[model samples]
Structures are given as C-alpha cells and as structure tokens.
Target: MPDNEETLVDVRSLHHRLVRINRVLRLAGSGSGLSAGTAAALWSITQHAPLRLSRLAEIESVSTPAISRIVTSLESMGYVERRADPDDARARLLYPTDAGRDVMSTARNARVLRLAEALDRLEPADRDMVERAFEVLSDALVPPEA
Candidate 1:
C-alpha cells in the first residue's frame, strides 16, 4: 500500500490532469455544436446507429430535458436529425445529419492538428507515451457498455 504522502500526490496529479483536460475540452468545444458530453452523444449515435432519446439521456447520465435541449441545439444547427423510431412510434431516434458528420470530421481534424502542434516539441518517446496514455484514458472514460 502507498503511504499517505504518495496517495495525496497521486490524487493531486489526477486532479491536475482532469482540470487540464476539462480546460482543453472547453476550448476545443467552444463555438461548436458539440461539447464533451454532446460529442460523446454524437459518437454514441454514430456507433449505435440511431439511438433513442431516452437511451441517449441515460447514456449521457443527464436528464431527458438535458438531452432534449442538446438535441434541439444540434437540430437547429443542422447537425442532427430526429426521426420517429420504427420500433416504437412514440419515441424518436437521433442520428447525425451529413452536416453533423462534417462537423465531427472537421473537429477531429482540428484536434489532430492541435495536438500534433503541441507534440512537436516533445521527444518522440514522450509523444508515443502520450498517445498510449490517451488510449488508456479514453478506455477508462468510455466503458464498453457506454
């Protein structure tokens, strides 16, 4: 078991990482239709291929109204479309429109470019470690069920 000092240091390091990631995400997501949670929603929609509104709300761990508001915002921006669910006429499914897909593609490219620029000065080994670390972090944040 780690000592108290070691545990505190580890916690502080994790908090710092979270804060930095949040700040970067806020910067990356600003002026875009996709914040971190919304981006996760979009990503899930793509992966699941026409997920329902209630399901999406559950996945995002937000209220139905919150998902509705996000979807409404996306719909207004022409990034997402809601169609009646075939299985359940009472429910609506969400999917990305072509414009929405374009938005995702452009944002992905921007993130690549931004991270690439930041990594330019790093040692190659450090950069590779960062890449691996991102994979681990992504896996932790988005579980298999999620």
Candidate 2:
C-alpha cells in the first residue's frame, strides 16, 4: 500500500497536471471571445437557467460582486439575460441566450477535439488508464448534491 505521504505527493502532482491541461483546453477553445471566468459563469447559467445572481455566486464559490461583474460582461456580449423573478419582484433571474448556447457548444466541441487529439497521442493502455482514472477522480471529487 502507498504511504500517506506518497499518496499526498501523487495527488498534488496530479492536481498540477490537471490544472495545466485545463488551462490548455481553455486556451484552445477561447475563440468564443470570453474570458475564462466569464465563460465559466455562462456555462453555469446554461446548466442552471433562471437562477438568481446570489445562487450563481454560491455555485461558483465567488463573491457576489465577482459574479456580478462576470454577468455584466456576459450580458454585454449577448450571452446571457436577466429576467424579473416572478416570485420576487425585487430580484432577477439569469438565463442564457440562444447565442450563448451556440457559442458554448462550439467552445465545448473545440475543447473536446483538442483533448481527444492529446489523448490519441498516448499509448492504448495509457489512454485506457487515463479514462479510468478520470472516472475515479470524478467520483471522488463531485458529491451527490453536486
């Protein structure tokens, strides 16, 4: 069995490598003309449409003001819109625009293609291991509520 310290080191190394891969994928799909944070916020809106700004901030784990700024950018880009909340007249809910969906779809495809190319360069056994590892990591990281 791996010692705790060795496992921790492996985890840290994996985290750094994943971060670098994510950065590369983000850049590869950056033709959508959105900043990383703004694109992430838009993706969140797409996933949970008609959500309140506070709820979005909570999901993104960012300050309300930070989310507000991201939303402002998305709104200006015609990627998202705010509609008055029916239950609460004082609040507005965010939804992705049709254009936003198209852009996000294209961006996702680009990122997937880029990742696929990288994976194709690996040996067959290594590729299989990477796929299984991702499944394990996903199960470990994402809770049932998430």
Q: Give me the candidate number with maximum TM-score.
A: 2
Clashes of each: 0, 0
Tens digits of per-residue lDDT for model 2 on 98-132?
99999999999999999999999999999999999
Candidate 2 ranges beyond 4 A from true positions: 1-4, 143-146
The residue ranges of model 1 lying beyond 4 angstroms of the native Cα positions read 1-5, 29-40, 135-146
The total number of steric clashes, by the backbone 3 Å criterion, in model 1 comes to 0
Alpha-carbon TM-score of each model against the true structure: 0.76, 0.89
Colliding residue pairs in candidate 1? none
Error of 1 at 7 (Å): 1.5
Task: Give the clashing residue pairs of candidate 2, or none.
Answer: none
Candidate 1 local accuracy as lDDT?
0.78
Report every candidate's CA lDDT.
0.78, 0.94
TM-score (C-alpha) between model 2 and the true structure: 0.89
